[model samples]
Target: MCSLAPHPFLSLSKPFTKRTLISLRNVIRDSALNKPGILADSSASPSRDAAVLIPFCNVNDVPGILFEVRGKTLRSHSGEISFPGGRIDSTDKSFLAGALRETREELGISPNRVEVLGELGPTEVNLRGNMRVWPYVAFVHGHQINEKGTLDTPLSSIDLEDVWKHRSLEEVASVFHLPLQALASPVRLKASKFRGGWPYWAVDVSDLVEAEKVEHGDGEFVDEVGCGQEGRIEIWGLTGWYLSLLTRILQIHS
Candidate 1:
C-alpha cells in the first residue's frame, strides 16, 4: 500500500523556496507523527541507542541531503559514509537533543540553525551490542549567500565550507551533499542489491554531490560503501532504504 510516487516531485526545477520548505516541513511533521517506531515491542533491550540527524539543505537552490565520511582514526566504522550522529549521551535531554548535539559537534551547525521536522527508526545488530538508531529529519538554515559570497542577499546557495568550521579531521573526514532530484532521475539509477538480499535502487551521485574540504580520496568511498561505480557515491543499504521510505512518504517514486 503505497500510492504512485515521483510524480509530485518530478518537476522541482526551481531552487527550494520558502513556500516549498514550509510544505515539506508540514508533510514531514504530519507523516512522522503517524509512522510507528521500529521497536514497538518491548521484548528486547538493545545495549545502546543512537540518534542521527538526516539534515536537508538547499544547495545552489536545489534541494539536497548532506552526508559525512568518517575519519579513519575512529575505533569502529571508520571511513564510513553516514549521517551526523553517534550514541546518545546521558546528559542529553532527549533523543532530539542528542542528535542536535552530535550535529553541532560533527558539522558545526548549531541546533538553532536547524528546524527539527521528524524522526525515523531502524536498529543494527553487531557483536559489540544490539543498537537502536533514531534518525531525526531537519532542515539546515543559514543566512543568504550571493555570488560574491556575502550574506547581503536573500537565500540562495550555501557554501557548506563556510558553515562547516568546527568539524574535526579526527571525527569527520569529509562532507558532501546529494541532490534530491538526482535520486529520482531514471538515468542516474543503477541496478543493485541490498545487504539484506533483495533488489535495491541505487543511484550514482558523483556529479551532484561534491566533497568539500574532505581528507579522503574518491576511490576509498567505493570500498567503504561498496559502490559499483568508481569514484562515485552510491546510495545503497540503509541509506537507500531510508531514502525509499522518505520517497514513499512523499509519494516520490524512485
Candidate 2:
C-alpha cells in the first residue's frame, strides 16, 4: 500500500485513455483541415468559399441521383430541391473537404466512404448577395441510415426505381407534360467585362423547350413543357443552371 501510494503519480497509458485518444483524434482532424488548393475559376470568389456534394448510387440497378429539399429556415433557396453542401470552413483542407464535411453533417454520410469521381462545373448565384457554388460528384456504393427512418430530416425522398428508372422518353414526357418543340438553345449564360472587380455573368431561360429538346428530341422524348409558375419544370434561376450542367453530363455519358 505504501509503495502504491508513493507511485500514484506514475501510471502506464491505459487502453482508450481519454486524454491520449482525444489528443490523437484532434491531431488527425487538424491535419485534414490544412490541405486543399484554390480554384481556377475566376467566377469563384475566394472571399466566399463554398462547395456542394451531389451523390449518386445504383438504383433499380441504374444510376440514381440524390437531391435534397432545403429546410424552410434557409435564407434564400429554402425548401428548394438541391444537393447537400455549405460554406467552406477555415479548418477545411479544400473545397472538396468542405463539401464532404457538409454532406456528412447534413445527411449523416461517412465522408471516407464517398468515392469522389471528380468536380463538375461551378454555378454562381446572387442570393441576397453573391455566392459561388462548386459541385462535385461521388459514388456511394454502400449507405446506412441512422436510427431514424431516413437520413436526417429529409424534406422528401424519391427513389427513381419504379418511379422513373429505365422509363422511356414517353414516360419523361408524360411526367412533366409540357409543350415540346425544337427551340434553339438559348444562350443560357453570358459574361460581361469586369469594369471594376469580378466580371458579371447572366443566365436566362428564355428558351426552355429548345434546351430540353437539345437532349430529349423534338417533342419525341418529352411529354409537355411547364409554363408560367404552374409548371413542374422550372426553367429559370439557380436550379436551372444546375439542371443544365446535369444534362450536359448525362448527354456525354449516354
Worst 10 residues of 2 by lDDT: 175-184
lDDT of 1 at 91: 100
All candidates: TM-score: 0.74, 0.47
Residue pairs in clash, model 1: 5-251, 5-253, 6-252, 6-253
**Local distance difference test scores for all models:** 0.64, 0.43
What lDDT does candidate 1 reach at residue 159? 70
Q: In model 1, what is the error at residue 237, expressed in angstroms? A: 2.5
Off by over 4 Å in 2: 1-46, 122-129, 143-228, 231-236, 252-254
Off by over 4 Å in 1: 1-11, 32-34, 37-44, 121-129, 144-156, 191-199, 208-232
Give the top-scoring candidate (lDDT): 1
What does candidate 2's lDDT look like per residue over 35-95, in tens digits? 3453324454445867887665433333345544454355655434456688888999998
TM-score of 1: 0.74
Task: Report the Cα lDDT for residue 58, model 1.
Answer: 76
